[model samples]
Target: MWSRSDAPRIMIVRLSAIGDSILTLPVLNALRDHFPHARLSWLIADYCAPIVRGHESLDELVEVNRGWLKSPRTIKQVRRRLHDMRLDVTIDVQGLAKSALPAWLSGAKRRIGFSRADREGREFSTWLNNELVHPSALHVVDRNLGLLKPLGIDNPTVRFDVPEHPSEIKAASDFIESRTLRQGFVVLNINAAWLSKRWTMERFAQVAKYLADRYGLASVLPWGNEREREDAERVAAKVPSHAMVLPKFSLTQLGSLFRRARLFVGSDTGPLHLASAVGTRCIGLYGRAVDRSGVYGPQGIVICHNHTSSDDAMRRNKDNDAMRLISVDEVCQAC
Candidate 1:
């Protein structure tokens, strides 16, 4: 437990995944609000740091390359950097060995982390963190907020102050203007990081056609890789006049784009959560039951019907059978 220092030094550790990192924004902002004079830092990997890079509440952005814990040189640098910061508290929001390493290395007394059940690394991260929190909240976002209980903040006003750079905002504006999406368009993120979460491109095309015909809204499909691009092209082929396949967009540009979007249709990926964070209505198609991990806000409409809710192990499986269960008519009805 922190001894109630006025200018407490804190470092929040959530190292990977665009979706989880976006969800952690509310934690950052709430911490900043409560401890106004505190020097707040976030430990994140370089790959996903772009998502929360320029957040107003963050005092420092401690970045590490992938697999930094294995590299002696990188470990030394991180140790030195964190040692200099003199973090009073370390919050391991990401409950894994890799995320726990920073807290263990930081030398902070109050290394807050989730309980054994919530955490993936029961043997490693559990012992590294001294302050244990057993989260009772249903949603992952609220479960994260529950960690703030040890800090005297309960029921904090949830906020995701997703930073939008001027250049990226301008770029998003230019693209929307050029595409003539001012009349209103729906962002169709047809790709999912996990294969199990992905729906068929043909089904996606049907939803795109419905949006165009029923609401007169265009569909913009964004892709991350070549395979996804090819899949997007196939979806676009069906609704040529209504759907437009977008070229590669940077993470920041996508954030800006979601802010101007009317609705977002995708699986439970980063883009869906990002769109939801930016106040865009999202129709999130889930492979598992609609549990706490579904889109955070009321604006999100999730479509899912599984025997049980999803966990980390279930989410990583190589089966699209659950995804196939979601019909195009279900998505169209949600639209």
Candidate 2:
């Protein structure tokens, strides 16, 4: 292990989904808090780089294109980059093969990672690290913070401040102006990457209509892909004309839109997590996954339930079914 006085250059690896990446920001913040003088860099998937770009706590953001990693030319590029930087402490927060390889190849004097028993990475990957942190059953936020335990850094209440951009502010303003939604609006994201996790289109329509009729709040539906756009349109068809569909937005633009929204409602997806991260009042729907490990909801009205049968619950654990059984009325009531 390197001495704290060595002033080591640190590299953190967490090439995961957007929400997972966002959830890791607190760890990054805490690392910065503990080692105020360390030159910190991050290795993240290409898609997630934008979220942390220009972050004040991070000294540099390295983009790892997964598609390129599959090619020899790309591997050479990555090797060259790592070779040139020569990190001192490489922390693998993703705890997976994809994230492990980069940290292992970085030639860092000391590497730290979560243990396989923690379900963060495979057993062999632990061998690549100089230090292995076997995490206990805790929230993912805390699990990530546990990596710093060996370094004598124990701050747990780290906060994430997502950077704001002028372009995004303009985009959000343009969207609001073009739509003429002058009154305060509720932003509802109706899409998820997985089909099993998405609520039915009819269910979304019912929720949107209820929010409009009962609350007199205009609903804005933001969709990413074609299928999601179709779903958004279907939901919009059932609500008032003032309830409109938003076009695809970049990460910064989405952040801007989220900031302007009074409340947000959506599935347990990246955008939903994005809303929560931005401190929006969020009501999330989760039917196929566990929210305790990754999803965050603000105080007062975050709704989650389980719908699985006894056998399925036994297989997945009743605690994992927190979001599966939440009904429309339950969520609406929470809202």
In the range 154-269, model 1's lDDT, one tens digit per residue, is 89989998999999999988999999889999999999878888999888888898999999999999998899899899999988998999878998899999888889999988
Candidate 2 global TM-score: 0.89
Q: Candidate 2: deviation at residue 3, Å? A: 8.9
Q: RMSD to native for every prediction?
A: 1.6, 3.6
In terms of lDDT, model 2 sits at: 0.76
lDDT of each: 0.88, 0.76
Q: Candidate 1 versus the native: TM-score?
A: 0.96
Lowest lDDT 10-residue stretch of candidate 2: 307-316
Question: Which candidate number maximizes lDDT?
Answer: 1
Specify the poorest-scoring 10-residue window by lDDT in model 1: 115-124
| Model 1 ranges with Cα > 4 A deviation | 1-5, 118-121
Using Cα atoms with residue i matched to residue i, what is each candidate's TM-score against the true structure? 0.96, 0.89
